[model samples]
Target: MPNVKPAMRVIYIPILLLFAAFLVIPLGILFIRSFETSEGFNFSNYIAVLSNQELLTSIGNSIKISSLTAVITTVLAFTLAYAVNCTKIYTPLKMAIKTGILLPMLLPTITYGFAIIYSFGNQGFITKLVGRNLVEIYGFNGLLIGYVIYTLPAAFLLINNSFKYIDKKFIIVSKLMGDGTLRSFKNTIVRPLVGTLGGAFVLSFIISFTDFGIPASVGGTYSVVATQLYQVMLGSIPNFNHGAAIAVVMLIPAVFGVLLLNYLEKRNFHYDKFGETELTPHRGRDVGFGIVSGVVLLAMLSVFAVMFVAPFVSSYPYDMTFTFKHLLDTFQSSDLTAVYKNSLFVALLTAVFGTCIAFSAAVLNVRTAVKGKSSLDTIAMMTNTVPGMVLGLSYLLFFNGSSLKGTFAIIVLYSIVHFFTTPYLMAKNALSKMNPTWETTGELLGDSWLKTVYRVLLPNSRSTVIEMFSYYFINAMVTISGIIFLVTAQTSLVSSKIKELQHFGKFNEIFMLSLLIFVTNLAVKLLCEAFQKKSNKQ
Candidate 1:
């Protein structure tokens, strides 16, 4: 324990209210609805839902596809992380690989499904390039391809961060003790990364399992739990009981995934002294891993190449003429323009409010000895355990008919909660590294706690605050799940608008909007990085 200002505990009230109203109450309402029936409340709804063959098949399909995607994505993410960390590759090529791997995340997930269809579909750009039809972009193959791209960025971040704590000298010691190549590799690299590797797989699996954007665009005849839940709740005929039952069912795996991730994360290895150690040169290792990384990045990013061309062509694969009608037509519509502005409005507010709340929570958790600090930390990260669809459905249920329903405020709040854990963790980690005696020092100098924080802590935390803002802005701009059910006609976002367009076979508008979103998100990331570097220099 350390010296802490008692007045600082006042920060807990707003944070608690935020979670209680948005996270707890909504989930409780969902639980109640799951048991609701025509004859009062009972377990009949769950019975009926579990008994349905199609729903069961969707569950099985989610597991199978999510599992396979986790494996392939983990392998790709690990190889990329390895090449960046362990191998001595050319500087710019490695930088390109790092930047390219995260490009998929810069756009809405729905775009990925569309990209897959246009890239590997009948008249896909890749298809034309290869002069042949590619894999079926309808069922399992389509979902598998989209999911791998969707989850790779996050999985890579987790594994790559884990690499920093590992000391490579252990491999040298093992080699001196007569360890062979295979044995040395396992003992040094694989052993230290077991936890993060497992974490990557689990995170990838949950993300794929709960995603609705991809399945909505490319599901065709194959359905997953998210799509089924969407149909039941907002389809031609709404069934609240069945929808609630399915929502509850979706939480089962998320809960288990959270538990397993916690277990894996506990196996952390620490290094007392980290050195600027250079790896021994092996041209074979460098060339092999570098080529593999480059090839995989190319394959994943090649899916989106059509976005830049498909929207600018005259009926792709039929007419070889360049045109700007797609751009002109999309912008001419007031609705499309308003939707894009709405996305920017929501994203900006989410970043501002989200950064404040997350930073406050982190300041309390790391800088204060407040009672229940541990619980606050847990609550801050709890969003990771709930899937976006479930949270969206819960918000829709809890806030129905209230003033908050169909308002921009609700969307911003939900986005904050949905993407809160990562930013909060980022804040906590950055704050924990600062001087722990700032409060005491300020108090002795006759300064209030808030003043000290504003003058000292906030300035030191500028880079992290910028990062949290960027993360919130980018995610809020592209997210389609947690706020899908909450958006109404007046408060529509670009992502949901793209989904609406898909129903009418508007591929031109879809790719155009996707490009817009990707450019916006990429700009935010680049600006954040540059801002951080400039601040560090100052």
Candidate 2:
């Protein structure tokens, strides 16, 4: 039995049970739909999906782009993580770089797509100046580039944490024994990171594969499974059956990837002969690395600045006029105000709901020996690695016939499933940091598990809980691909509106919505930091 006071259970249990139901029942519906037709329990949909050339092409393209993105993001993240954590650099510069790298994570995918178009599209000033199609901000190239920007934050955070676990003495010993920088890097850095890098790569690849917003905005003729799912399911006439079929097809790969990641994580553990400790600074590498890191940081900033400025201009490149008319028109001329309101509503709800569920699950898995907690952990892991498109489509299959479809609750459910993994990890990591004896001590004193959680776990893990909430809110505000099918005309989000504006060649309006989403996310992030500081003091 779950030990606790009845009243406390009344408050928390219903919330978690609702989340659990949402997560499981939707995917169950997808599986059932996939196996059924009017003819009953047939594999024809799977066969049709497999035999379709267009579907195959989309699968191939998604794999290619996701692979390339995984490589570029991992390499860049490794370099940046090493530069900051290992080198003796200026504290301000390091903090600035870390913050800047994270800035892209806060903005919507449409924002990145818009920024790329303004800088590289037909009327692009930079493109025209160079007198070349320097880069096509559409099709394969554009989606690939945008995904790299979109998934960098999670990749950086994971790889940096992995680096922090490595012992510094090993590197120092190797360096003192006449090892060159290259050899030392191979022995010390690459060896430790090999498993972690693979995990990051697979995780990012899954994210890019399932993402829809960037591809929808800049994809042009290039189609991915996510965009295809959106078109078939939600366009002109809804083809629920075809969408369900594709959803099933997409889920196969995601489930396989998640399984593979689990297997890899298990095999990744090699008993660390050397214990964890703080790394000693390497002063010589600092100057060279600082400059290189600065250049990378500058490139990232330039993209953001373009995004920031493009909306303010009346028309980008061609007219060079300035106006808040675009912003004003969002409320006056467009249905943007509703979309803005809906996006914020979903974000706030997702943040609160997701954080509660993730924290409870983490507590169950880490702080208590609850039955089936391992399964809960595994389910959370599986969903985290599952592509957003798969989950969204699954929900469509599961809920379209139910009262949940075409509702705000659906969007909240999608956000929770789509972004569950990171927050779970965040919460578990927070719980892990607390001394195990705290709970044991409480048990000896006859305090219930619920009481211990109330007095100790929640208070100590406040910063991490807030971090998870902020992450959920920021990603939900920007996410498009995962919840695309779930969103109705009534629930159109700012991100979807940005995509709509882009399709109609409403560049200025697109920029305006993108800017609004970005600014709102930034404001929320600042608020999270303020709360974190206050919590630390208390």
Candidate 3:
């Protein structure tokens, strides 16, 4: 027993420590810096952050916009997920609808901003569709619309899967026992998905809260914490202190959202393990409700269609010509190519290293009988609350004099740490699904723990590893806020370059670049799906 305890520490404690260093240590450093003063520790930074009228206004704006988005998106996603899952929609048609809902998520948020501008800007194609423009698609409107697109896939997927897990027999029994359609729906479907609904709302709120791209493009003088962080770092007068203070402020909402999600995940995640229940179709309500839901799904698809097709138009609404010149010029530019290469290299390295760290942490938490696994959990939970911009600032302070400052290595490292939790949770889910008895039997048969991991765990986890890779790659490609500080001119990422062109009002080039990113991410996602199927077959 003595040998076993120490051996578990030997295997698990290193992973726990690494997570703590990467995730927990940086936040502590941020707090320490926030309290630092010329004379001694003080709350001057916090005082300034809290006292500023502009800061107060920005926080208010963020809350108002995020609240609007949460309600609209949740209602829409719930409608779509319910209509398709509960009704007799054709399977292929259902899959296509699901794909369309997810298409926006695969693209970068910057792309959504550009797409919205071209579709609704002053000289936009659809702007003229009305005799005169009734409302402007800037500020709150643009932010809310972009958020719905940005978060649709996740919210839809979450609720859609939740709907699938509910037993349709419950609904059928209710109807046969004289419950009305609306009455039965409320009692059976909505009640069961309440926790998931809350989970989706909080998740959407957090994504919108931390996003830096959409507001930058179409916000049009709209002030929020994300854009405020950008303004602080602008024009060669880097305000690291102010930025860190704002970053710490942003951490409050993100932390609360994460805590809420953790609570809901624990309460509502059981249906998934209980397995999918069979459906009993309703005739009258299914037809009418399904048609209404289909219209909403079509509207969701129309947004993606506009985003994909707008780049091919030669000039805005004026020329209305068609050409591939925009595409040719975007990839043909040597500057853009360098940025693309930098982004690709960093994404590849992040996938490798992020996967390594997440896999290790998951194994340590699940397999090893170590005392400090709670430490790893704490790191992940705290990191999930840390916004990307704050993370960037933290790296600037922590690694400025170390061996990591101002290099491509640091950017890659930042990506790995910035995106650690998603993959960690994903891999943990995959690990938990497998029977722990597999490991026990292997140990009883005299196999070493290491051999059992290689021979048992890795093979069973091939799908998860691929999913982890896609998550890392897509996030790294679209990430703007964290790597923005780390990317030198020599090592510019595509995300930063897109922001550059947008600032210069090169809207055409911006849309083309966004299209390219969407295509590249789509290709990567497809590749991951293929690999998942191959692994399943094996």
Candidate 4:
């Protein structure tokens, strides 16, 4: 028996209130507003959006670029994942490849556009080195490259985790049975990964289609839906009705991605065991895969290398002399300095409060047998399917005149709800593996349920707790879409400030602020890793 039966009930009240106030109600209002027009609620807003040829073209462009990005990113991710797991490569090179692949995640996606510009634009770093522009770093070409780099890390992670469990011994068996190389490879490898591959495509497509950061920076003359939605909502003539309609349309892919992914997940082949076997090492395979994977990793990392160069130069390409004037300029401006402080403030609070809410919901669902507890899981995770910009607009619609409108509380609240699903699932997974009889055993020892939870449950999952905190902190520091509309003049964040700097053609300042964000997130990530390792050893 749970030591105290009512303890579950006590925890349920606050979780329900928080979700009701933040997630459910705001989205509900946005849904209604999508139908609202000057003549009252109807379908005019949506109909007008669909009727516009420019808007329709932008939607088509989003599908085209996102589809291309998904395909290219998934293929590259597979190559990297295969190299890590299958090929015999230099160990130090493998470590570098893995780490470099995910370096983009440390900074905001909004910075991706600027990085691309400084890397390949006519007067760019690499262009100067090579003495020719490789590709135009704007419009469709830039969007393609930026979106690929942005989504590749996630695709690679999902595929890599799945690859670890695949039985490689089948490859040897297929070869010995006289199966051709293609047929043998298909049977041994791709068959088991069809579900994951499909899932990666959907995930990449959804992420690229819904992103605002990459599109905003590099999408010049290429009018994607994200930019169009921004024009309608925050443009010179703001229209809430139409913007909500576009946001509702943006939600279509997310919903489709979720449903498609769920279906694909069911098709995965679950193995009883992943038995290890010795590989037939081919020198050609090793060299081919090693060079290819190295090049891909280098290409992705090369994009951000300008962050180190652009900020320190007197004026990149023109003045080769090193200078700290750009750094000093940023620090001297009080307004700019406050943006960095605001990001730290929002991220820290979001980590603390978001962890509490997610952990509470997890404990409610996994530990207690409360009826309708699964509903909390559903609500907590629903944010995963909704785009961040859509969430920001929904909060704007619902909380337009409320006291929380211009406050940091609104940003923290949105961050918690936006990022609630993953952390909640992490906590739930961590708790599920603990002894189910822990509470019962504690009761025999005369410990109350709450007391047992604090003493036993909390200490056992401290590593997971640390991991959850780091996830919230890094994402909070880097996320832009959901929090973009919520930040005020007084509450500007470094992520949003990059946009402001972009408008003024201040490339150096943009790189400096990006570096600041990268350093901050890297610090949190390192601390969390060190702490988690210590906890594991203990």
Candidate 5:
């Protein structure tokens, strides 16, 4: 309340109201519905969900798979990140490795499931090359692989960013003090990164646990909470109460993830000074890491290569003739074309408006002395812990009888709110790095807070703004969980269509549609990168 500018107060109103209408109220309705029973308000739904052996098993399966996936993904991601940062590799090789690691993010999570099947299924290319089925890809093994592919990029990004803040001088000092290599690495690198590793683990686990698309495609008969929630909510006979109960249960782990991440981050060690020591490569270590990282990158690229090739074949494993029939069919199908267009429209809208809202909120929170800005920040962060399935179902229940139930507008709004946190943080980071005296200088020269943002802040953060826009656009293009329930016939998206195509055993069309999405997102990403490079040069 003290020293809070009136302009800062005005900025909080719209942001808070937006979250209240789209996020808070809908989730509140979901919580209320979970408690409803046939007789009265009670725990019947919870009892039924917990007592059902199959449902409980799905919960257990999710935890088991997610935990295992987290461990494997964290190790691989950390290795890749360590090689990139800590070892000496050719610059092109390093860039290629980073690109390979991130390529998975451009496609939908379900696409990884498809890639796994296309690569390891009975008649898969790899299986054919090896002359046998190396592994079963229809159950736990497939789900784990899919989760690893889908979650590795995000985990690597987090862990890699953590490495940048550690001072290299600690390692040099440890060496000077007669410490061995292993002990030096433990004290300097591993000890400082424990918090980041835990955060990455929790994040990867939540993403794998709540993702419905991957499990739906590759988890044959192996149930998970996400797929179970989909079944209860949209199955032959829809049961809102049961669905709400499942959603409520899903929220437990997500909340725990947020709490656990916060706790770990708070306990992270703070170094007194950031050492300027540069990392020098040891010949043996560098060569060893280069070989290992090269193999990992190639393996990751092979999956996408299989996905790219699958759409061109006449029939996978049955016929080896190359044909564009599947791609033609994907575009020729009227419904599929409309869904693709819908995805484009939704992603475009989400990028433009989501960036504006996120930037404005960032300005209020980071650039001005806003009293209630923390409330807005808290609510925005809470959306991260709320699974997309839960948020989508909550919207379904809360807006059931409303006019916005089956509209594209609802999807756009839901996507914006669902993905608000990352873009907000991007904008905040960009703004925080600028000259803090910009606002004071503007005011002394007669510019208002809003004027300062437009003239001084926005222009300087143009690269970050473009990045935020691209982030929102790409995520909106590939996302299925949050908007799965919200998309209607008129607003069907390509990501949802991929799921439908999977259920009908249309593998060719599935790969074709997924390829379309991948190419589209990749093109956008490259364009953004080019723009950023040009801006930096200028």
Candidate 6:
């Protein structure tokens, strides 16, 4: 491999060191800890995990629930995506459907679990309206509902993007051959979407499997790997060895997810040519799908509506009157206020620093002649497959008794590494589309690589940078599992506060805090969008 420019090498060293210190070291520590026992280094922890019936049961439950969630979410998401992208629905209706499906991505995952409880629990408002308990808000059923909503946006996004490159001419050709509706659909749509569907299923499965928030809220009497890991790590005894063991076990499915994703990506078919002809919609088919899609969207929206309204009421199912007491009580608490501020501080830092590091890393890997950059890419991508509970516990074990313990800086660092893969991919995608000769152009002008990047590349990728910043900020705000084990009294976050409140059955306050997070994240998102728009116009 050719050597990279001196200036580019300078940029790579710090990022390499950052990942080494924060990501590589902690994970290394975790691997060692998983093998340790009271008798010294051995496989006792693994044996304990395997022999424990409840632990094994949790693993089984997680797989079962995640598999079901993936299938259901994939089917629903594909239908909705197909409707919005392919059908001849009214423009307003299409936009509404898209917005409705994407809305779940904006709020915290914990919110969905609470929303289900408040709307479908025994005393739920919707349940009462139907004069019966429509669905259980605990155990497998509750998790199924919550996970579907939690993972739907991801599946929909991937499946929808696959739709864009598909040529409509294939469908027209199938029709021209006198193929019936089902045959045409199978040939044109399903055939091209096979890889995407597999990718979506794997992605959704990993997300649902590793998620702790939803299970913690509504997984009554049901055991899953995420919640079990939390219990072992943070419960009364606080067993790090067993926790590490559970973390190792939890990683298996995620690894499989990553492998499947890679395989699917390799097999994915790309079409450079798209059809010029528009899709002709059938009246009956369009109207039927339109109504069904509308109902599904409305159902998903109602959960959020319940989340918003439940916080204002004095008491759910008991007090019909709306009051501001929950909001006041939440804000007036000194601890809560500090936690909220700490969240804001951490999110802002993560956004700024994470974006800079991710952008630099993306540039080095994509554009520069940086040798061995693939290692860095591998590490970053691997982080995506690691569960937050696993990563957080690893940090706890790695940094315990160190000076960095209990500091906001550690939380910020963990968050940056935890969410690094997405922004890095975004930046890499944006940069890959630029003219390949930009580096040569800079050389011809006697400009260094760094200078060219500073003046030419960065300015052109402004929208993507803003997007990366927002992604980091919003995710940091809503994430709880990643930072749960690392937070101290001095560095508590709003998401963890919501979890704490949930433990004590403080439903109103939980909803209020969740609403606060939603509003704050929404404000940041809108601000980023406005900035991007202004930059584009300028």
Give per-model TM-scores. Answer: 0.98, 0.91, 0.92, 0.97, 0.97, 0.97
For residue 34, model 2's alpha carbon misses the true position, in angstroms, by 2.0
Candidate 5 local distance difference test against the native: 0.88
For model 4, give the RMSD to the true fold: 1.4
Q: Per-residue CA lDDT of candidate 5, range 1-538, in tens?
A: 1145677677778888989999999999899999998888999999999999999999999999999999998998889888888888877888988888888898988888888888998878788888999899998999998898889899999999988888888887898999998999889889999999998899999999999888878899999999999989999999999899999999999889988988998869988877667777799988888888898888777877787777787777787799988888888999888998999999999999999999989888787777677776787778888999999999999998999998988999989998998999989988888898888888889888778889988889989998999999999999998788988778889998888887688888888788889899999999999998887776
Q: How many backbone clashes does candidate 1 have?
A: 0
Q: Summing lDDT over every window of 10 consecutive residues in candidate 5, give the lowest-scoring window.
A: 1-10
For residues 1-538, write the lDDT of model 4, one tens digit per residue.
3633888888888788888888889999999999998798899999999999999999999999999999999899998998888888888888887888878989999999999998999988788888999998789999999999999998998899888988888888898999998998788889889899998899899989988999889999998998899899989999999999999999998888888888888878877877998677879988998999999998898889889998998988799799999999999999889999999999999999999888888888888877788898689658788888999999999999999997999999999899888888889999999999998898899988888889999899899999899989989999998777888899889999998888899888889999999989888989999999999998
**In order, what lDDT does every prediction score?**
0.90, 0.79, 0.78, 0.90, 0.88, 0.87
Per-residue error for 476 in candidate 3, Å, reads 1.2
Better of 2 and 5 by TM-score: 5
Which digits, one per residue and each the tens of the lDDT, describe model 6 over residues 419-500? 9999999999999899978888888899877888999899999999999999999999988887889998788898888888
Model 5: which residue pairs collide? Answer: none
* Candidate 5 local Cα displacement, residue 232, angstroms: 0.5
Candidate 3 on 1-538: residue-level lDDT in tens?
0124445666576666665665567767877877776768887878887898897898899988987888888888898888777777667667777777877766668777777776677765456665565457888888887888888788898899788678777777798899987899987788889889998899788888888888987787788878887777664687667667778888889878877887876666334334444566657867776676677777555555555556677766666688788778877888877777787888888888888778878877877666667676777776677778888878877776777777888888788877888899988888888887876788789877778778989889999999999999888888887777677788888888888887688877776676777788899999999999999999
Q: What is the C-alpha lDDT profile of model 1 across 1-538, one tens digit per residue?
A: 2455656757877787888899888989999999999899999999999999999999999999999999999999999999998889888878998888888888999899999998999988898999998798898999999999999999999999888777878877887999999999998899889889999999999999999999999988887888989989999999988999999999898889888878977876767776666788799999999899989989998999889988888887688589999899989989888999999999999999999999998888888777777876667656888899999999998899799999999999999998999999999999989988887788789889888889989999999999999999999999998788999999999999999999899999888888888888999999999999998897
In candidate 2, position 414 carries an lDDT of 83
Residue ranges of candidate 2 with Cα displaced over 4 Å: 1-20, 128-132, 266-284, 331-334, 437-449
Clashing pairs in 2: none
Score candidate 5 by TM-score against the native.
Answer: 0.97
